[model samples]
Target: MSQAWLRQPERGSVGLLRFAAWLAHHAGRNATRLLLYPITVYYILTSPAGRGASRDYLARVLAEPPGWRQIFRHFFCFAQTILDRVLLLAGRTDGFELAVFDRDGLLERARRGQGCLLLGAHLGSFDMLRLLAVEQAGLKLKILMRPDHNQMITSLLAALNPAVAATLQPIAGPADMLRLRELLAAGYVVGLLADRATPEDRLVTVDFLGGQAALPATPIQLASRLGVPVFTCVGLYLGGRRYEAHFDLLAEQIVIPRSAAMDATRLWVERYAAQLARYLKLAPYNWFNFYLFWQA
Candidate 1:
């Protein structure tokens, strides 16, 4: 479904998130498997169009499916979603461990009271990172998200997790840069997705997963403008209802190196792309780019 459909009154962001949490808490592994069986069968039989589209795109990107392995990969992805929702509902804070790479590097920068920007992908349970920031690091996190398409989901999340609702700040475009700047000025950690670029956004073309892809340049631009450090975080699901959140400092200071001349954008874009590929290779199924990404 398009994210726009999520805006339906009954499925507002808050409501949908709460429902997800409820399912996570109530559905055990076996129960969730049984419940998802019908949906799986239906998708397998009725989603030929979508499957074909995905197949075509994969072929163009030189990522063609290896027969049954690809099928199992997609199946595991569907199953992972069920498990992720359950974990979110269970709220078992200590059940998982965060394996932060180059953490001290980021921490050292954070201690300067200048704040930092966290650029992440939609690969894993992004929401879970909020808890780690607040509960583990004692840092206030502000998430920039697109406004929920569904009012019902939004309302439900507001009612069930007020803290999360309070921290979520939705922005539509670069006009919201002032707010982001203000947050950084106040030493608050700001996190945003950096893999998707819309028409109104600045695009940074990079080599990713053996192909050229475009990524949103807002995160890099904002960090450079604000003089804040940038970090890339990747969350990996390690099974048994656990996840490992990895954080790495991407840049100590996003200075346009003198030697790069007019190629500064390309330099930074490649850096980000290389790091992203590394993580995705570690958890291929976790890469959640559902739409055509490497083309157009």
Candidate 2:
């Protein structure tokens, strides 16, 4: 979880990813993406922890009939295929064809000389958002990421994409808080992935996907402290290298009511969780949470 780990080089994993990327690029879009379905299914079914979670969740989702669960699982796989095609095309086309939601409103709000929080999830390519921010919005976006265990993979992914590396600012400890505050003061948009809550982090419990789950309270707390607006941005993959970059103004204005920081944080987190649920329902497979989201 140290910042130094994120700087290491990938030894061989990059090669495999590059090959996969090439296949996704050269082969017929639908065909190549479809071929990946079995691979994903095989991994999900073969992995002990993953299979158990998938089975349990599938059962819960289709409690009415046993056959219904299998049918939906197959449909989910089909949807994943289409989503992969859209993602492949988005990368190949360099984001020109990506459909963006609330393009003007997001920018206008950002340009209003106030700090804003850009909250995203683990659903799709967040790096794509970095591209849009730098290329389209003319802004240097900074992301706060939880340090990954696989240092090599983290470094390689960052090094492979210069646009993403240039704007990504890795945060390790409380020491970086001042720097983050300064960035906000300077009107730089700060991006945070809010779906996962680790034991080491402060979290707020909320109902997500029809169950109770703990979500990171950092983003809302930071926004409240800075007295700024908070927005939720989602990149929905449409087929053929097109993405619908949707943005919702979660909190048009974050006000720290006198000594009520905790209450304000809870309110915003509830609103965010509700919106996230709606989007996940619209595109279930788009949710990339491999682990069980709701833990008691």
Candidate 3:
């Protein structure tokens, strides 16, 4: 179900993002936002895969078949966040108000100078989480992701603010892994989107939203190896330039003994998936992995 998402094409080009950014800066948020309507509708009609995926997810979450209006809202939410990403990366949140909930774990970790793995899903705007957490909490946050995952989007954001690309530690090679080790040992918080897996990644099936799906086991594996605490984070878009960030400690420390490595990994992956499910419920439309997740 997910290999295709890994192989899916990037929806927008760098030129599009540059134009959107220019519009936001010159025309302003309200006027620039007017473009999202036609853009969202274009995707709904052209990208049948995305449209069908949205409908399927809504069907399960709403407990019935969803209509065109609901599907359009889902697409609109996704488009809005994407448009805002340009501004968020440019360190502009003037129009947005963020409310963080239950961030004690992150604050405590920072106070102790203990590094952590902040595990987040495709839900909501992770750009907001990284922005506000560092701004308000004063945490040195670094992101670990597949560098080539979305070269188009990555390039666009980097063009908007080059430092955004500099902070990302790509997991495409072992050197990046070694760097991640160093960052954690040096007591810097590292964030990862743990829900999707690349072709080279490992997976473990877990129950999510009433069905089983393959979640990337790499995050748990690294935590077990690094001996760092894991915290589940979500940056839920509350619409209209408002967001609510939620952080809950998932594992104070993931200790997987060698003998029971298999069992231990399964336990934590399942735990993460369950926690992700809970966060999805808080902002159903915020879920942004526009791919079928449940295993057939």
Candidate 4:
């Protein structure tokens, strides 16, 4: 919930993304994947903030302090996810191994048209989860997103699939809130990224990666108001062509009485932070918040 990510400039341009998309489609994935090496190297060399963030995160997650090789791999893993996002969005999931670990039956509920709040962190390939929940499991999923955060990437991804773009409910004004309520009422799962807190958001600090980091309280707060089921989800990239989507129920219904609202919110946020940390260690390179994450 440090706003450092908001302060950082968008790294790649639309034209560059378009070219990458073009290459991905025309040349096969194996051929196009070769480009990620240079792209990863370019970012590692050019973006000092991103490099430092990688080092800091890896140092906490790994047994030993991270070196150039670990940093390069971290950036490369992120680049790989970005590349796969293009393919996944374009409906080109031919060779990739897509696995889902939904032991809690949340996905089955989604498949049955039961509405819930899917709260996730920026830990892995969200596009993969979207593919599994929407395309595969047939869940009516509406993602709450700020399109203006990374306009170029958003625009490019939208261009790939207009249908997916239509599912994006922009996080603006009261009208969007009304839209979310309507969707939930009609049995649609609302997807939200809960880790990053904007300036307007209320936050709760928790122990994360051996340090105290603030996370947004608003997602859980909104769930409490809406009185819906809430689940924590993530799609982990397990190297090579394998990706796994996990879904775990966080709450049957989030209820915070006014008298204990702060404590209630903190409890839920801490639970989410603990789950996120567990997932972070499972695939450390997949933590893609490319900024000083432990700072304000």
Query: Evaluated with lDDT, which candidate comes out highest?
Result: 4
Query: What global local distance difference test value does model 2 have?
Result: 0.60
Q: Residue 145, candidate 1: how far off, in angstroms?
A: 1.4
Give candidate 4's TM-score: 0.94
Estimate, for each residue in 74-125, the C-alpha lDDT of model 4 and write its tens digit.
9888888878888888989888997888734776676666789999888888
**Model 2: per-residue lDDT, tens digit, 1-296?**
11221232432224334544556557745566665556555554544544444454444444353343553353344344333433333455443466676756667766875666788886555555556533467765677765554444456455555555555666777777787888877878788887766555567777665667677787777777776668887775444455567778887677757687667777788888787766655554455454555653
lDDT tens per residue, model 3, 1-296: 86668766665434446677888878877887898788778878987888888887887677557999989999888878877877888777786888889888788887798989999988888888887765467787788878676677777767778776776777788788889999998888899999888877788887778887888888999988888888988888888988988888988889988898878888899999888778777777887878887777
Which pairs of residues have clashing backbones in candidate 4?
Answer: none
Candidate 3, residue 258: Cα displacement in angstroms equals 3.0
Error of 4 at 123 (Å): 1.2
Model 4 CA deviation exceeding 4 Å by range: 12-16
The TM-score that candidate 3 achieves is 0.94
Give per-model TM-scores. Answer: 0.79, 0.77, 0.94, 0.94
Error of 3 at 27 (Å): 1.6
How displaced is residue 165 in candidate 3, in Å? 2.9
* True-vs-predicted CA distance for residue 242, candidate 2, Å: 3.7
The runs of at least 3 residues in candidate 1 whose Cα sits more than 4 Å from the true structure, single-residue gaps closed, are 1-20, 40-64, 78-86, 89-94, 148-153, 173-175, 257-262
Residue 185, candidate 4: Cα error in Å is 0.9
lDDT, residue 88, candidate 4:
85
- lDDT for model 1 comes to 0.62
Superior candidate under lDDT, 1 versus 3: 3
What number of backbone clashes does candidate 4 have, counting pairs of residues 3 or more apart or in separate chains?
0
